[model samples]
Target: MVWNWQQTDWPEFRYDSAALASLEETFLLRAGELFGAFHHVNPNDRDTLRIELISDEALKTSEIEGEILNRDSVQSSLRQQMGLDSETRRILPEERGIAEMMVTLYRTYGDSLTHYGLFSWHKMVMAGHRDIQIVGGYREHDDPMQVVSGPIGREKVHFEAPPSNQIRAEMDAFIEWFNGSAPDGKSPRPALLRSGIAHLYFESIHPFEDGNGRIGRALSEKALAQNLGQPTLIALAYTIERNRKTYYEILERSNKSNEITNWLVYFAETILEAQANTLTRIEFYIAKARLYDRLRGKLNPRQKKALARMFREGVEGFKGGLSAENYIRITGASRATTTRDLQDLVDKGALTRTGERRHTRYWLANTQTDQSPIERRGV
Candidate 1:
């Protein structure tokens, strides 16, 4: 069927109340409270957290594009694309841009009562890599209907429109509504709902020749900040990457219907998941913090500094231990001071030594597990 682009008006779509209700149920007051805590973390700490989350999200999204989706491979792709000069390993470039953008979004939210500038959000993502084209902004070229992949193993489908020069105009209108008119002047919708809608609207527009999905997702987070009063702490990108097919299918079905209920519902559910995961991480951090605190009375300043650094950078090698040399570099302490600190930590039962003599290193006294016993206490 030849679809007429000019004939497609967003108002023709209907909102599904049932779907919206289901979506709202997912983000009860408790979820919001948890998300608020996640938002209060330091921006640098948040950036560090996102480095892991976005790396996983980008990998998962790539897998949706039919590439192998895993932590290591995705990390490799990110390293080269981002030009992160590493002393030992590669870092993903997208993570850098995403982290930087989120910080800007968060800072902007604090300063303005209404932080819904599409250009500002767009500029944040564009700052690092304009050459990437960001996937979903208005197209300057042929402006053909954008197609994304279908159900796994199925052929891709395009959002086709009858050939017309007004393709650009159609795209522009979507952006204008998306960035400007969608939120009424009075009580704006909650950030989560607005973000969900922004995701839907931008995808429906299919504005860019490429990178629409990535940019659309980014816009969703920006909307979340404006509506929710906090930028995201959860890894919603990872959630979408995990349920890529369901995500697209919901969008497709909802786009054909009136009120974007299904799409919004799905986005809400994912937000809940992302928020929950973030809470889980926060619990771990608190637990870890307490554990570190418990040792503070037992540790000297040097030992405490070294341990703090270890927690931040993560333990290295399969042994999951640090050497005297590594401690010296991390603490910027003298070799004798590093040795004394390591020995003191070992004496205090905060760390344990592994290997013999020259090959020896120190590891956290506790064993590593996905969810530490301390973490279960919620710190």
Candidate 2:
């Protein structure tokens, strides 16, 4: 099947901008409100949000390509690269490379998408790998660059990119299109539209021997961030990873034509979903800090320790909710003391207990609270 890259109107994408109004509205609604709420988030928590977004993007983008990175190492590598707390621990090479690429994307969102920039990103993404024939540059081998699946003799060719001989020229055109379509460029497109097209355009070229998917996602993030005037910090890759099957399906279909309304709508919806989830996470952080402030100096040491453990599980707030037995395991308190401390935490507005008797389970109070301004604004 012929791809868009081989069409007569190649690189001259066409779509009805009017159709994106609903998506653009939702996009604006979430982005405008969420960022305003960000101003109210504590500086420390905001840093946490930034790290989580970057590290999560790094990890999920890799996982989409079947590379499972160590979450702890990825986070640590991100913190170190971001210069947070001057993190000095050794980072595994896989984690370090993706973390570096993510941080570069975050820091350089406003910069022009250049060949050098892409090459640097490619080098970082390909770090720790010794066998790639074209590290840090476009593939030079004459072999076809094909996206395929299944066994050696029974493979399915999903899509094939442009010839390797044409990569440099294709990439030059892609870079020009990318920068020229920017918010500040000659023909500025809407944020989601530009982002969607940018990602599609980059992926169709598939310039690198490895790491094209990761870099394409980065370009999309940069496009969003550049238009919005800050790093979006949305769980874009995370959301896409969860819907990876649909992502590939839509991408494959969109590759067949330049009329990409379906692709844009799908991507826009994905962005909106990602932004909403990010808002929930941010609200949780704000509520968490506020709860900590409210409970300060009011809890016994065991209660404080136990509550902290519960919160360490993040927005989901401990698996299956925290149980008294779980509390005893965490705090080493007697069953009697664990029961009392858990009860006291509930009474002090520090937790919300659900179930009863042997079925009893508890949750961090902030998760249940309807009081956070962040949550209120998020709606």
Candidate 3:
């Protein structure tokens, strides 16, 4: 028989604090470093990073549920949410809806979470999917809801949510606990731990007919933001999406076992990894910004556009540095023009070239060194 939270001493999750003690300290320290670094950056850089992070979160969270959304559309949606122009593209309803939900999580990170708030989020998630029979609220029927995989007949149910009748009571208790444990509430809980628990608890309940996974992750994001007293640049969903199999396995294990220590440990470690990744990205952003500053007004329009594309693509900017062919593709320049641009960049010392003929590639001259910004900062 599969064990569920409802049967395991309802509303009181047991976890070993000692098990998470060291991890919690490390996470808090790293989180502080990330937030501190973010604070020191210019407002433009900050906005750029926020757009990238939020866009990644929206995309990855949906990807976790096996839903693929257009990356450009999502970024456009996030730009609109930030009150910026949509860069010559009309906002798709789907993009607008998901962006609205993500913005709400960030904007109201510190607000008292309520059932109505969650309901609104659900509505946003389903805004563009009119064909789906499921509505934007709690399921009315009590049919068993299980996450399954494999062929239709040979499907395997990973886990089951609480019965429909139990959703209201379960959600009520969850909302009360969540609000009561806010930083200023009567029984304040550690923000990190509370986020992990909230995620697990919400998924276990599976209140809405659809979009539970996304909403649960959004809630986790909000919890982390609230804990940090500001919006976090880290996207936990990116890490989760990468380790999706392990994510599901841990959730299943936590649901089946009475002791949630293992789950907490896993969740904390995931957060640690997410924070570390965010720090590395921030360092990259700073490095790229500094590089642009140095190269400002030194390169022609084609060279500048090619360099900007390389920064946007990051590690995968090119298989090697960047080939003339790749430059042409990115900048829509003629072969002759592309070659001239590449040579101009090399001449200006903004890019370094290597290899012979088609094998030749170019890399940011200043970034030829292997050290990242974090290392340079001596962190």
Report residue 160 deviation for candidate 3 (angstroms): 0.8
Task: State each candidate's clash count.
Answer: 11, 0, 0
lDDT string for model 2 (97-133, tens) is 9999998888889999889999999988988888789
Write candidate 1's Cα lDDT for 1-379 as tens digits.
3332334554344455455554455555646766666566555465445555556555444455454434654444444344442444543444444444444544564343222344444544444355644333444555456464578778566455323355456555555555552244343565556677767766666654444576677677666655555555466776676667777666666555445555565677677766665566565554555576676567667777777766654322234478988887877889777777788778877778988877888877653434221111100
TM-score to true structure, per model: 0.58, 0.90, 0.90
Q: Which one wins on TM-score? A: 2
Cα RMSD for predicted model 2: 3.9
lDDT of 3 by residue, 133-211 (tens): 6566688676787878899899988888888888888888999988887787788878678888888888888888789
Pitting candidate 2 against candidate 3, the one with the higher TM-score is 2
lDDT of 1 at 36: 66
Evaluation by TM-score, superior candidate among 1 and 3: 3
The whole-model lDDT of each prediction reads 0.56, 0.85, 0.79
lDDT of 1: 0.56
